[model samples]
Target chain A: MRAVAALCLVIGLAVPALGWAQEDKPAEFPEKLEIGISTDEIAISSDFRGADLTIFGAIEGYDPSLLAQSKYDIVVALEGPKDNNTVRVKERIFGIWVNRRSMTFELVPESYSLSSTRDVETIAAPPVLNGVGVGIQHIRLSPVGYLGDGSNLTEFRDAFRRLKESGGFYQRDPGGVQFISASLFKATVKLPANVPNGTHVVRAHLFRDGVFIAEKALPLRVMKTGIEQMISNAAYNQSFAYGAFSVMLAVLTGWLASVVFRKD
Target chain B: MNIFIILGMGAAVGFLSGMFGVGGGFLITPLLIFYNIPPVVAVATGANQVVASSISGALSHFRRGTLDVKLGTVLLVGGLAGATVGIWIFSLLRSLGQLDLVISLLYVVLLGTVGTLMLLESIRALRRAAANQPVSLRRPGQHNWVHRLPLKMRFKKSKIYLSVIPVVGLGFGIGILTSIMGVGGGFIMVPAMIYLLRIPTNVVVGTSLFQIIFVTAYTTVVQATTNYSVDIVLAFILMVAGVIGAQYGVRVGQKLRGEQLRALLALLVLAVGARLAVDLVVTPEDIYSIVSEGVYR
Candidate 1:
């Protein structure tokens, strides 16, 4: 009887030890993502062309096992400040092209860039990606008092994406994100010179086995610097003063040129 | 944006501006648009550049003692009123997504008519000169309906005692075209002063430019306040090149006769007009256009 008791006690201790190990799995993969940009602010001056932003990040407690099944899928997306943006499709009417029907998507990004480790389709299911707003299709395009029975909604949305994409406002670079190590990753986002001046949001998402594991957001600012800033503020804020200034400057320049060049 | 291309284009525009005593906006706008600059920005910024160029020409005229300030003031009143309407039309068409179409149509018509008229008139003058036929200044000595109009005023410098109604009407008409074309209306204004208002050619350029400064200034303010489409940087760049080009143009223009100069200017205008016409008639590469609020600025 004593021998049997000893075996029972040993077995009980081993089972809990194994159970505790299983419970520690969540702790191993911390649900935290930390990201930082190479620069906090991008200044657009007179000669502003497109610029590149380096985003480096470290994932908390990344497991090698996640890669055994498939390479870790990391998607980084940049969204401009939310505003009501209109999208229209042109149809040939009477041998001339004119805008037909239109749709407005509230909270649309002026510019969107997407980068992933592999093809987005290979990383996760459509529902999972869409739910988490990972792909272009997943973007929340809340219609602003949309007309019709929402039957042709997809058509308008697709046109919006197509237009933005053509203008370099929207981009999809599958190879944009590269992993340096198991727990570290980096991405480079190229901003066109015409990128709107405003606050932009950058999101980093991690997925494993078609399941979202972690997500984080980092805010970025795109702004005009030096004279560009001054002029922009004058026009938008003190509009009357700015207008007066422009006229005064033009008149002064004209008069000055005449005075300087007048011969006899 | 290729800086070299912009500078080169600026120099060419500046030369033409200085030679013809024009603002060069008509030429600059199309090139800028071709280089992928947004149309609104192109138009507004072109206006800003015109103000500077016109002011220079006007100041020279003022120094030469050819400018008629009294007549200019009358035109200024009409121009300001017309500019307000022009800006409103610019914005209305923009929202309707038809500004590009309207701007093109206006350019084709204005340039075509003016260019053809100038060309034919210059050819006639050249033939008269070649035949050694003394060119007589044509004037109507008899009183006509134009003189019968109300609010008659004396423009001593232009040597015409005419009603302010026609002068103001002419100003108002040119003002509308100025805003739409992003020009100082020099091409139209000079001829209008000579033929329509019967102002002497000696002082017409100065008077027209004087009025243009005010007209474009008003346009600049309105566009800046309402549309916020002007790019100061772009304007500054173009201005630098324009100033230099104008200097060279003045030197070259000194060697040409009036008819020869008019014929060349007519040809240049016709070329630009024809290019715009082709774009309108030809099917575009992409029927669908994409613009956003951000690009509007």
Candidate 2:
């Protein structure tokens, strides 16, 4: 009977822990979600600290009604390991939620519907950080709204340049090509220093008017290289030590209080 | 070795919080940065830990019949409104990408001014005490501008006759600063209560903590839901330790001479202020990118 009681007590405590563990898993992806990051593996040189990230993902299935009413926004985040679990810390580097008309594209020349024209709204530039070196830089490209008929490439490039000048998108080289066909578009940008090391997510959204038409999220891994990795690992692993330090301080404070306030 | 150092740092912060009645962000933020934690994470985590400490401390004070609920409520109402406006302002600056420089400059100026004032006042108080004279503390005059304001009210604990407008205005200002800086604003609130509102010393301690509880709690929840900035696990651990430490601190506080305590606190504040001032004047190690991305974007 004693052993059984002890066993029951242990089981009760374990139940909540198990439940929490299960709940900690990443949120389940929607059934038709299509996600992909710009790169699978990023290599950093000893001199390398951070880089600009381009996240591109697409979504296919859409309900026209949902796309017409709700304001659609996509959030890309970075998650890292903490105490044996992954935790999300940063938020959307690329937010694609704007009025649908501003982002909409048109198929030019009704008979030549073989290619669609997309007005790629300006991409926002990633945040710049100071010394200590290393972190993720992000650039996002997403369609603004449902494409209509008669969209032109010149109009698309104008919009893209507008975004760049407005400081929402990264400033590309003067002769840089901004327009790409959906089938053969591939571009790689370098990452800079001050980028954080972690698992990063990139997201995209298709909006109509002000409503969301489709959304996609993708993950990219950013790891430390050479000396930086060792430093980061050492720093992160200090949490347990900090916890223990706090407890000791509590004990000391309690003892001090007892001594000082004691009635002589 | 790393574990020991981290624990030591945590204990140091807990002790300072207990002794000074501060939320410990002034200490914790620099330490987190020293440990190479990202600036955003440091601020968010510090705010989270503050919630736990304030909540636990507030409950204990409430049980002791020291908390002035009516005053706390009014302050909280104003604080909430101020926080909302402050958050909006922060978002606007962020969208403009000018938030980092602004916040950094603000921190340097605010901390230096407050710290200097505290140090000077404590020195004056100490000198008076040393001469074996009863300190002649200045009382707010009846003809003072604050009293001239409309809609005056009475606070039984603080035993002051002051206008609700001033109280609310003070709360609103403090709330906005707290929200923007991720600070509890106790360092500012306590002084405001004692000097401006003319609240008694004993009442100020409990009342300030009372107001902080609500303000920090609201900040924690808002940041969690909107920004997803609160780290519950890290906060819980610090708070649990803080609670026990605060309990003992209160006991110790009761025994210490008030003047001496003030002097010690003044010295500590001045030290922190000097360090922050240096940071502003000296070229920073890194000057770009103080704002972090969150769900708000």
Candidate 3:
């Protein structure tokens, strides 16, 4: 009877300890995404061509099993300044192509550069990506005005994406994101030659087994440097003065040329 | 935006303008459009370019004692008012997303009509020269409906009592063209002054140049203020190349016959207009285009 009691106690203690060890609770903090860029602002010179930007990041509290199985996916996007964009479609009218219909999408990014661990679509379902607005094809483009039947919505949206992609404004790199370590990641995005000068947002998203788990965003400013930027700034900020100066400069140039090339 | 290409375009247009004695604004705007510059930028910068190109000609006219200040002032009154109205129209069309279409259409029509008329006139002159026929000269003091108009004013330089109604009306028309088409309007203004208004031959070119300088300068300032499309770097490169080319053009022009120069210019204008028209009719590779509003300040 004493041996049986001892066996029961041992089994009870051992079972609970085994259960506790097996059912390991997730870290106190959920998986979090942290991203860092070397510089907060990029100064574009007058002769600036396209540039590649590298972002380093880390996934905190990530499960080792998921990381080893490559079940984790990372997507990093650099979104340019947002503004209302209008897409116009030209149709044949009287044997001439003319812009007959237009749709304005409210607060759309001027440029977008996306990098992902794998194809964003293969990583997650379309609905999920659309909900997160993570992929170029999934970005939300809500029309500002009234719609009659919403039939043309898809057509216009597709056109907007197609044009943006062709113009090199919207870009995607399926294999641009790679894991440097167990939880550390590196993502590279492109800055187009004609990148708009404004505050941009670098968004990092982490997915575990096709499910979004974490997101982090950092702000970056793109500034133009040199004479071109100064002129552009003057044109926008002090418009009237700039206008007057343009006229004065033209006058001076004209006067100087006339004096230099005087026939008399 | 290849600087060398832009310089070449400017120099080419400048040479032609010097040879033909006209502002290169009309040619420059179309060429910029062909080079893929936005129509808005091309138009505004073209106006700025005109301000420079017209200055030298106007200065030379002023020095030659040919400019009639009082007559030009009367014209200026109408030009300034016309430019204001034209700007309003320009902005309205821009908002409607029809500015490029309208500009292209206007260029086609204007270039077509002007080219046809100049070609025919030059051909006739050439034929007359071949037949050894004396050129028929219109009497300067001939009376017409323009002369009969009210508000006749006397100008000592032109030595004619011209009606202010026709003078101001002509300036008003040219002013609108200057703002919208980015032309100095000298090609149209010169013929109108001599044939329509019966201004003295000596004073006609000078008077038109005087009006052009002010109107184009005003257009430049207004376009810069409103559109913010005037590219100073682009304008500077064009102006420098243009002025230098004009000097050489003037020398070559002295050796060319007026009839041949006019005919050549007319052909060039017609060809450009035809190219623009073809672009309008041709099916674009992509039927869709996007314009980002208020994205760039």
Winning model by DockQ: 3
Off by over 4 Å in 3: A1-29, B295-297
User: What is candidate 2's local distance difference test score?
Assistant: 0.49
Q: Please list the residue runs of candidate 2 whose C-alpha ends up more than 4 Å from where it truly belongs after superposition.
A: A1-264, B1-6, B140-143, B154-161, B247-267, B280-297
Can you give the lDDT of residue B117 in candidate 3?
A: 99
- Residue-level lDDT of model 2, residues A108-176, one tens digit each, is 100000001122232211231111001122222223353556364344435443433343222222112
Query: Candidate 1 has which clashing residue pairs, if any?
Result: none
Ranking by DockQ: 3, 1, 2
Instruction: Pick the winner on DockQ between candidates 2 and 3.
Output: 3
Model 3 chain B worst lDDT window (10 residues): B288-297
Note the residue pairs that clash in candidate 3: none
- Give the TM-score (vs. native) of candidate 1: 0.81
DockQ of 3: 0.57
Looking at model 1, residue B143 earns an lDDT score of 59
lDDT of 3 by residue, B242-262 (tens): 888888899999998999989
Give the top-scoring candidate (TM-score). 3
**Candidate 1 lDDT by residue in tens digits, A58-171:** 665556686655556788887777677777666766655566667777778888888787777777888888787777777887788876899888887877777778889888
